[model samples]
Target: MLIKTIFAGFGGQGVLSMGYVLAYAAMVEGLQVTYLPSYGAEVRGGTANCTVAISNEEIASPIASAPDNVVVMNNPSLEKFQHQILTGGVMFINTNLVESRPVRGDIVLYEIPCNDLAHDLGSDQSANMVMLGGFIEKTGLVKMESVRSAIGDVFKEKKKAKEMNLKALDVGFDYMRNNGGKA
Candidate 1:
């Protein structure tokens, strides 16, 4: 039941926050979890990524060399981590922003219109949540209920963001359920 996942995007796209939320949700489920984040020198638009490992057993490290699942929010991230996904892994792409597809055929690919969906929900910044929703639906790594509960704890200070983020997450999950994954 070990799952190594990576979330990648620009710094302002909430990449790290998604990882944090995932780690927190895993904790709530009583799973062993580790989260590590890295960002480029430039803050807002710089490259940002986070690796999270969740398992029923002890986690040896936070680094994920070959992640079982990768969520890419932008084209650069798609290019950066596309080849790093393990065989039989799943890659969730924010199709609204990433125009390209993965070159590898062994891994599963799930295309999500994250930015557009978030905009439909009235907040483009919630794109990360949309991706998270799709990832959860596709992998069942964490229950949406756990994520919902974790959201309150994660964004307790930002009341408005909490509501929008929850909605965006629902949108992503529903989209994935309604539309099957593309390998």
Candidate 2:
């Protein structure tokens, strides 16, 4: 199975980090993966995004013209990438920061209040993990153990932040399982 996903948000929102962790996890799971990151001139509070391609077979291209899934963390990202999702694709929106909803009917939409959920978990910075959790659960592309392992490896430099991020991932995963990932 091939899953091409794009994660977008302003800088410092862990947008690239999420993609990094996912790509790492996919690699650890023995899958072929590719990651491409983009950002605006400004580092923080500027547009940032990454495209990840995960597949069981060899991938010929790294670019994703029409992503199979999308995770939009802010309003601008929602506006920018909402229309680029393929028909019957899955889109996860962070409701805490993104007020706009997807207009497409063919795709599945999951409105996850990532920031709020992360805040509730006592760390607003981990909002991306919450969204990542939902995406992981919804897509079932990567296993939880692999994600958790990647998180530990990804955040190895910042030991104090790892626990909360793992909790945030669990919160996102549980939220999707309980709430149902549907519009």
Candidate 3:
């Protein structure tokens, strides 16, 4: 099956990293994947968004006008892209930062307390990964092992950033395992 996901938020929320991690996880699962990020200009106003496509076959388009899944990390991002998701799609909203309700009741809405959870895990910056963990767990689009490795792969060269990122991933994964995507 093909899965299209879009993650959008303001700058410094790890929006691009979320898409990168998801795509890398799909690749580790031996699937075809494409990750496209929109930045530079969009970040001028503090918006950052990215599209990730994963499929069993070749993905012709890297862009998703209506994604099957969406991760929104801010109120503006949520309000801007909530309507762009397809009916019956799954959405992960950062409840800590965004208190407003989503537009679609038909779709599955996960009000994830990402910021709070990340802070509890010792870093307020890891909220995006926490939200992603819940989404990944619910969708099962990627394997846990693959997700872990992907986090390492992204941060290995950075040295100083590796521990923090992997720890964040684990915290997010552990939260999902414990909470089962609720609360």
Per-residue lDDT tens digits for candidate 3, residues 82-158, read 88999999888787788787866778876668888888878877887887778777888998789888988988797
TM-score of each: 0.97, 0.97, 0.91
lDDT: which candidate is best?
Answer: 2
Computed on alpha carbons, the lDDT of every model, listed in order, comes to 0.91, 0.92, 0.83
| Shift of residue 13 alpha carbon in model 3, Å | 0.7
Q: What is the per-residue lDDT of model 2 for residues 25-56, given as tens digits with 9 covering 90 to 100? A: 99989999999999999979999999999999
Q: For every candidate structure, what is the RMSD over all alpha carbons to the true structure, in angstroms?
A: 1.0, 1.0, 1.8
**What is the Cα-based lDDT of residue 97 in candidate 1?**
81
Backbone collision count in every prediction? 0, 0, 0
Stretches > 4 Å off in candidate 3? 40-45
Model 2 alpha-carbon drift over 4 Å, by segment: none
Please tell me which model should have the higher TM-score, number 1 or number 3. Answer: 1
Candidate 1 residues lying further than 4 Å off, grouped into runs, are: 181-183
Ranking by lDDT: 2, 1, 3
Residue 163 miss distance in model 1 (angstroms): 0.8
> For model 1, how does the per-residue alpha-carbon lDDT over 102-122 read when each residue is reduced to its tens digit?
889898889988888999899
Error of 1 at 53 (Å): 0.2
